[model samples]
Target: MKRLGLILLLLIGGFSVKASYKQDTTIVEFTDRGVKKRVTVYTSSKKDFELPRNLNLENVLRSMGVDSSERKKALVLIEQNGAKQDTILLLANDGRTVKIVAKDARDQLSRRDTLRNDSDHWSRSGRNNDDDEDDDDTTTYVKPKKKNSGGRFFSKSDFGFYLGLNNWANGASTVPSLQTWGSRFIALSFRRNATLINGKQMDLALSYGPEISWNNFMFEGNDYIDRSTEQVEFLVATKDLNKSKLVETSLNLPVMFNFGFEEAKLKIGIGGYVGYRVGSYRKLKYSDSRRKEINRDNFGLNDFRYGLTVEIGRRRGISFFGRYDMGDLFKSGQKNAAGLQAWTIGIRL
Candidate 1:
């Protein structure tokens, strides 16, 4: 009777042990938004609790009640045993589905080594046969890092120089012949760019800032820019028209809408600018004695200038720009120059 009793007791003990091993499970609990969610992960054996090799992180996120649209901005914290890892969900490079990307910690261990160490620790803990007791290991939770959105605002600044061919249009009379090579316009600007729409493959931006524009109109005829009368008068000089030039300077405010395409390889900007005249003057050179004269006067130029501006080119490469003034070049007092307007076209550097 004693021998029979001992055999039955051993069988009962073996069955209890097997049932306990089969009941081992891992419960993961987290909060998404304001809702609480829980998931149960079953282990294949008591000695090992491994997630499936083809586990889909996106599906896990969805199961946790995360909204599909908000998933891209969501961060996931995974804790196993005592080790913790932070991951972010992102669209795959092919743009077909979502994937997990580990936010690397500052530890010196390689990713493979870290994961291996974690698995080894869990395996060792399981072999100790302490499944019924609560684990004393401290739970580590990794916090997500903040991202820089860099939206359209005071985020970035740019500086550039522009050189353009200058010309003038007159409706009352024939346009004066100009020294095309010497007639030039130049501008220097400091612009602040704000991103309006930051798309995955393209970006739309707006830039506005202070600019200084200088217009130099070189004439072929022997003419003098008369500030007193606000008009040009023919001059009789022993020497031919060696040099006849009128210069105008203004402080301008330019705003532009920029479209960047092909990963910013190509860019186009269309905008307008308004400026207030700051200074004006005339310079003349005589051929007989090669004498030069500088007259610092308003030269009857308009007090304000406004224009339409355009730019197109490769990013950080040579670009072409054009500006057509809508305001008259000279004030209304000049009879024949009532419809005179200035325009420029050139390359930017």
Candidate 2:
């Protein structure tokens, strides 16, 4: 009877030891600048362990062989036994945090791709999922279509360049003809487009943005622009006006109404822009010296300008644009200056 009892006691002790070893898990808590994070590490052995003493979180991650660049953006977490690892929390610079979890290998490409997909969804629905944690767990992430991806009529933002011909209309007697191909208007802008109506066949949108418009007007014949006083004058050059040109630059705010059809394949925008004169200059090429001379001045140009613009084309295809200024080129009190309104026509790419 004593031998049988001893054997049973030994068997029970051995089973308890095995159970403890199987359940060995270490919970590590990391605190940095009042921010606390926790991770659970499971171990097969029941031996006790401790993290390196007096080490920072960054140093700890480095010791784990994490790249330096990723250390700043990565959140390290360990899985709990039998608990679903369904979401990951991401921190942003503006104190906003987002949660993301990959459902499969296809969704685990790069962080950029993940954020881009989320951004497209947010842009379309104007809803952010960061604050809503109780929604359905199974989210199907389909890569967004590239149609009008570059410049959608209802997109929140887009950027592009503007190129066109620059000329002027004078209300006075007659303005000199411009060098047809030599005169040019060039600009770059950052735009915001808002959807008013999105439909299967047609869409209506509104757009507004800031732009820098550079106007280069090449003269015809021996004519040159002069601004000795409050008035802007057109003077005939003693020498040939080979490459004499006037350049005006302004900072402008443009607003437009846009219509799009067939998934933005055909788009038309009508808008107006208001600008403040930022710079004015003149360039002259002298035949005698065969040298180019540049002069920077206000040139009696108007301090403020307003203009109308029209755009028509395929969203990503070549588009035609036209601009006509409603205000005079120079300030009031310019004698015989007439209308002196500037205009441009060109293609937008």
Q: Enumerate residue pairs that collide in model 2.
A: 171-339, 172-338
Query: Model 1, poorest ten-residue lDDT window?
Result: 35-44
Candidate 2 per-residue lDDT over residues 1-349, each given as its tens digit: 7546534643553444333333322222222321222221111223332233333445434433335564454333212212232233332233222222312223333453345542322111112333222223323333323324343335678886899988877666555678999999999989988888866456788989999989998988888887777667788889865688999999999999989875226889999999998999999887777788798998878889998999999866778999999999887777656668999999887
TM-score for each candidate, following the candidate numbering: 0.56, 0.56
lDDT (Cα, 0-100) at 231 in candidate 1: 66
Cα RMSD to the true fold for all candidates: 17.1, 19.7
User: What is the C-alpha lDDT profile of model 1 across 294-329, one tens digit per residue?
Assistant: 999876678999999999998667889999999898
Where is model 2 more than 4 Å wrong at Cα? Answer: 1-153
